[model samples]
Target: MTPTLSEVTVGDELPALTVPVTRADLVRYAGASGDFNPIHWNERFATEVGLPDVIAHGMLTMALAGRIVTEWAGDPGAVARYSVRFTRPVVVPDDGVGTEITVTGKVAAINEDGTVKVTITAKAADQAVLGGAQAHVRLP
Candidate 1:
């Protein structure tokens, strides 16, 4: 359901979302995105390049983070703008457990124009991976 503008407050927090990223997910993303960077899949290459392990694509992480706002708005088209800075790589290991990314959002502001600003924080292993992330959305 779309959250009515009147039902939201500056400090209101959206539901938290946790997503697991596996090696298979990374491979699929690479194929679909045509981002054949070895660092995203080749563990040896990644380690040699100074990465902890295979890393997820930045866009993939951003999309997962944006999903919270789109879902809360009940319409993907409701998003007006979104921006984020990649603060760290989401290192994905070969283990079956992989890594989990957690996303949380808080209502930052309600605009006079029927829009809202949402501040987003995305973390992995209790460490922030996205910084200065925010989303602008239209509410019902």
Candidate 2:
């Protein structure tokens, strides 16, 4: 059964999601989104631009977070609102340590319409990468 608003509390935590960031993944994302920013695909350009390495697109990371919320809600349309801030860059290394995304949510406020505003914190490799990830979800 899906979780109802009343069943969740202020400190409830969402399940974590781990995604391996690879050069190929970044390339595919760039192609799919039509965002061919050199810093995301070209190592030399990324370095010239003062980045540690080719970084994953911010939207790619946001999509991963959306996946976590969708999986928990069991319905993508159930998410009334979703947003996040990219606090850090996700670097794809040649050796591929692989990044893991963990998200936890707290019930911030419940609306009169039976929707709950959830404040989410998403982390990668134990580092907080996305903060203030908020989502308004319909109660089951």
Candidate achieving the largest TM-score:
1
lDDT of 1 at 54: 88
Give, for candidate 1, the lowest lDDT window spanning 10 residues.
1-10
Question: Positional deviation of 15 in candidate 2, in angstroms?
Answer: 1.8
Return the TM-score for candidate 2, rounded to 2 decimals: 0.87
Residue 18 of model 1, lDDT score: 92
Candidate 1, residues 1-140: lDDT per residue as tens digits?
A: 57888899999999988999999999999999999899988999999989888899999999988998988899999999999999999989899989999999999999888899999999998999999999999887
Per-residue C-alpha lDDT of model 2 across residues 4-112, encoded as one tens digit per residue:
7768776666676666778888889898999999998889999998998888899998887777667777888999989998898877665666455666666778788
Candidates' C-alpha lDDT: 0.93, 0.79
lDDT for model 2 = 0.79
Please state the error at residue 29 of candidate 2 in Å.
0.8
TM-score list, all predictions: 0.97, 0.87
